[model samples]
Target chain A: MGEWSNARATSEAAGIGAAGQVQVDDDLALVARVQAGEMAAFDVLTRKYRERIFSIIYNITSNREDAADLTQDAFVRAFTSLSRFKGQSSFFTWLYRIAVNTALSHLKKSRMRRFFSFETINEEMAPGEIVDTLSQKSAGDHSAQLAELQEKLNEALQKLSPKHRTVVVLFEIEGLGHQEIAEIMHTSEGTVRSRLHYAKQQLQADLQSYLS
Target chain B: MKKRRESRHEVSGGVTLEQLLRVKRAERPGPEFWADFDRGLQQKLFKTVVDRRRSGVRNFFRIVLHSRSTYAMPILAAIMVAFGIALNRGSGDGPLPQAVTAPVDMVVSVEANTRASSPGAERFVVDLLNSGGESGNFRKVMSLGSINTPDAGSTRYVADQLGSVTGRGGVLSMGDSF
Candidate 1:
């Protein structure tokens, strides 16, 4: 969060329109610097990729505290394994792999607990503690159209299997290419396409109530 | 392209099927989103560095204390090689250089005990040594010479190899001068 504050301040100064546009070359440069053992370079990379990784974890785990902890663990593992990172894949792809692995390990550990079902967690209530404020803001009024859609979407996402949820998150939310998602998931592109197809069907069925 | 275009259709509800399909491929998150992500990611990175540093320090001392041979062998070999090279550079007495001298004696002595050792190995050694002796590949470049008579089969094979120095290529002959 240290350099994130600075990044945020810089982006804010740059204005919102320019903020979304992170140049791929710049990202690669920063990664090179990170590989060269520059902490500032790593900090920039963390700032750039943190939210996407966090969002993916949050989508699956849906608990703020767990998300935060898992996210930190993910970054830690990524840093330690950075030397082994072959540049065959992009930096984000590598980061995504680390995040997914960390989250899965967390889920595996929690699976022993009675109430530890990942699919049962509410998406809106994810990033667990941090959302309390947001939840309170929407406490009384569940009447808004966008809010209702968001709720429906979140609920439907929770109903997915971990594998399908991952496919959906990467393909739909994260918007990675099918090939890229295939690489991240360590599967064939055909499998990614099939899973994505099935996931979309399931999501559509789950949110059927909202469609009308 | 055609298939994708055909596939792009609005669903029965307000949000199209295309919208759902477009999610991950949809436009990237805004700057505010990234800014938020950065904060959380940095804390995670810092925590990891600290953890690794702690683990690294522990490992460094553990290695120093145990003095494991697995760790020691390569280091020892490297140092020896370096020292050998350095010694050769100054006084010209390196083991590798000495092994490859062309003028060195070609006869490599072998223990005559035949029943004790494996068969054909002597012949193979003889062939190798004889080839080296005559061609001087092993003797001149490798600085190794001499095949011993105790291993008669190998020695004879070496002798045969030494005889073939012209076409078959043997340079080191038995009793050759170093």
Candidate 2:
């Protein structure tokens, strides 16, 4: 098990590195075109990252309408401030920072009006993936049980503080590293790790019934 | 070994946090939503860019209005001072015009009253004030400095007329002029 896990980790790290390199090259080319006064190049960058950016915002806001609006706002801000974007970071990183900051500000302003409404999951996944993962250590009818677990998961997520929720969403859902999350959150990696640990502990306590 | 143990501990729950989060990754809006999103975003971006350009012009004016003392006041004062110097250079014939020497508050009040009164009366008073030499009352006031000269008799005559028009109090004030 240890050997297999180590091998998987190695392969995943290599895959991420290669993917990141390709993304960096593509983003640089697109950003250069934008800097040279080609407005259409920005559309390409927006198209590429819009879904991911939207997903990040959606997880934070939990309201599709607010997410949609904020996603547009983030892209608009990025395009307007594109000239000030020195290539010190990858284009996505800069874009991600903007999107995160926009969402955080929105959350701050609309704190009183926060209400959670979970959306249905429709993406293609291996049949019973969530159920199988859960059932490996417990027991349930994989189909109906998975639905309940999903609802519980979203409830637990919404219960988290915005700061904790943001770190968890970015790290776990978006598969970002602690360092990357630290950069996005504008804090030390140690803070990011601490928040993630506390967030997971809270989730564990909230979903204790489902997990057991 | 510690790192491995930590990794294992992270996934100690029946389902890993990553797997639970994956459930959410699947919860995206449909294709139709994206179709609408792209079109809506395009329109919004175009409007935003255009609005930003418009606001840039507006912001320039706003800054000028707010910071008038800094950039605009000095320029305006300089122009006024230069115009005054030019007017002074040209006016060697006599003392400065009564319009220049008159108290500003009195002129402003007269101008306001003239505007508020009948148009015909406004036109006459404004013309009389502008053409100061011809008006009897104005000529008397202008010649006060030259009372000892040949205009002393004319000054006394005009003062009596002004006293009648302005009443008893006016006659007392005009006594100094005589």
Number of the top TM-score candidate? 2
- Report lDDT per candidate: 0.54, 0.67
State the TM-score of candidate 1 restricted to chain B. Answer: 0.25
Put down candidate 2 lDDT per residue, A1-212, tens digits, no spaces: 13223322322322445546776788899887766655557767987888889988999988888898899999989977887889987687788889999999999999888876656676354224554554564454444445555677888998999899998888777667677677778899899989999999999787665442
DockQ of each: 0.07, 0.13
Q: Count clashes in each candidate, considering only residues at least 3 apart in sequence or on different chains.
A: 34, 0
How well is each residue in B34-118 modelled by candidate 1, as lDDT tens digits?
4454445544544454555567668865675578667666775676797787556545433444444533333232223223353
Candidate 1 per-residue lDDT, tens place, A35-144, comes to 65544555556656767787678666756557756776777777667667767766777788888877777767786551322223233323222233234434433223
Q: What is the DockQ score, from 0 to 1, of model 1?
A: 0.07
Q: Give all candidate RMSDs, comma-separated.
A: 21.9, 25.0
